[model samples]
Target: MKAAVASALRAARRVLAACHESPDGDCLGGALALCLALERAGKRVVVASTDGVPAVYRFLPAWERVTDRVEGLGSFDVAVALECADLERAGRFAPVLAACPVLVNLDHHRDNTGYGHLVWQDPQAASVCEMVYALLAELGAEVDEPVATCLMTGLLTDTGSFRYSSVRPETFELAAELVRRGARPDRIYELVYESRPPSAVRLLGLALSRLQLSADGRVAWSVVDEAMLQQAGARWEDTENIVETLRSIAGVRLALLFKVEPSRVKVSLRARDGARANEVAARFGGGGHLGAAGFVARGDLEDVVRQTLQAAAAEVQTGSG
Candidate 1:
């Protein structure tokens, strides 16, 4: 699979690299790393992200190159969808990628839909950045300072600062190699984790204040509505990490966060070992890793929260049994 993707990329003169909608560090970092490497190899690369780069990830090299527009960019010889579970997960850029002659699906999600002409997926891999590192080696592209920094961003963020169970010995070895190639783990950590804006802090406080626990103490949840955003002067992106925070509570096996938008409620799910958060998310047409997943449902905030929490409670009950 690596050789196939490398061959396709080498053959293509113009390439489109796209990140999933509501992209996190893994998606943007891997896509940008690829873009930088491809540009060095003399290929014309355009990185697209419908939701654009979040402020926290703007420090990644070549992040400014990511554009939200797809029109008038012309067709590409190949299009690479990074960290997208399915083509539809590409969001607004889905049509553009589908129209490409060669579509490459590169992801680390367990529920990947297996779309695209060529796919390279590994559910066991810690992050797409890990796969991108291997792909660069397959293409014989240099993992220079800039490329290393971009890849490191994904590695650091996706592993939850090396706190997740997904981190393995190889993950650390890869991080060391990236550091030797000029990636600064300290700076990356500070920028991505420690440098939240004041508004984001305010939003986090609001979300925590609303945190609720199920009767059995196995399911935990919180809601972030438009009113909270307005009150805190924060954007929806500020809601990041709130679900993980919920999951950290003692005896809480399943945690959920419901973000009420104008048209839909976006629910983020996080669970400890043995709890299948993705299964719960799939009940609402969503998918993700066993420990982390999300879904979007169209309904009143209270209704969506009620339905999702019921499903989460049921999942916890089954896991405990």
Candidate 2:
């Protein structure tokens, strides 16, 4: 497994790590896991992105270490993009990505175009965190409490707390050990699921009010633009959980909740009853699991929403038939 993280790091002295913008569990987990591993190996490691670490994930030991400053940052030996596809996907780290001597891409996205000098894309691995797990093992580093916690965070989030089909026996077995080593599953569940801001509840209500049903009620959708966000005093974080509600509606196989931003449309796709949301997301340059996927559509909200809905419909029809 040394070859897994070898060819990339061997060519470098200092390294910078990054993940996709507006990161979810997998992206943050992957970035911190690798950052910890690289730092332990005596390499200078900087992990960064556009935003500060997401709120619930502040529990991670490495969460406070991330920075959002892009300009005038020092150069690096290798730049690793974790759970991300391209330079633009790196957000604030785009400059570092361009200046680095070598670029390493580590991701589980099937649609990733291998946007780096060294590419490690394994769609079958469930989560990039799994690969990072192997990398730490191969590095012969000790899996201390902090390391286990970071790894388990990615594992739990990507697997939906062991609810998704991606949860292999080994995944749970690894998780069990993480818990033993100090990954508080209960603490994480409470933070991720139990906590919701007031604006978020309002956004949820708005999304439910706007839920759109496609032919036969197989697909459900709701979109909130900047106007809605301004009116509701809501932020992007507030909208994250709202999408899952549409997906959970009875008999609705697909749910797409899009947040129309000023520059880009943030799309979240969720599915039930065996629909392939990942397949649909992939068609539009996104990557994720069959049950959950997303992408950014840069255009007028109406056009993007219509195109995405059409694509989702086609994917469901194709898969169902």
Model 1: lDDT equals 0.91
The best candidate by TM-score is 1
Q: What is the lDDT of residue 116 in candidate 1?
A: 96
Worst 10 residues of 1 by lDDT: 312-321
Q: How far is candidate 1 from the true structure (C-alpha RMSD, Å)?
A: 2.9
RMSD of each: 2.9, 4.2
lDDT per prediction?
0.91, 0.80
Task: Name the 10 consecutive residues with the lowest summed lDDT in model 2.
Answer: 1-10
Task: Indicate the TM-score of model 1.
Answer: 0.86
Kindly report which residue pairs in candidate 1 clash with one another.
Answer: none
What is the C-alpha lDDT profile of model 1 across 1-321, one tens digit per residue? Answer: 989999999999999999998988898989999999999999999999999988889899989999998788898999999988889888899999999999999988777889999998988789999999999999999999999999999999999898887898888999999999999999999998898889999999999998899849999899998899999999997898788899999999999998888898889999885889999999999998788899999978878878888898889988843
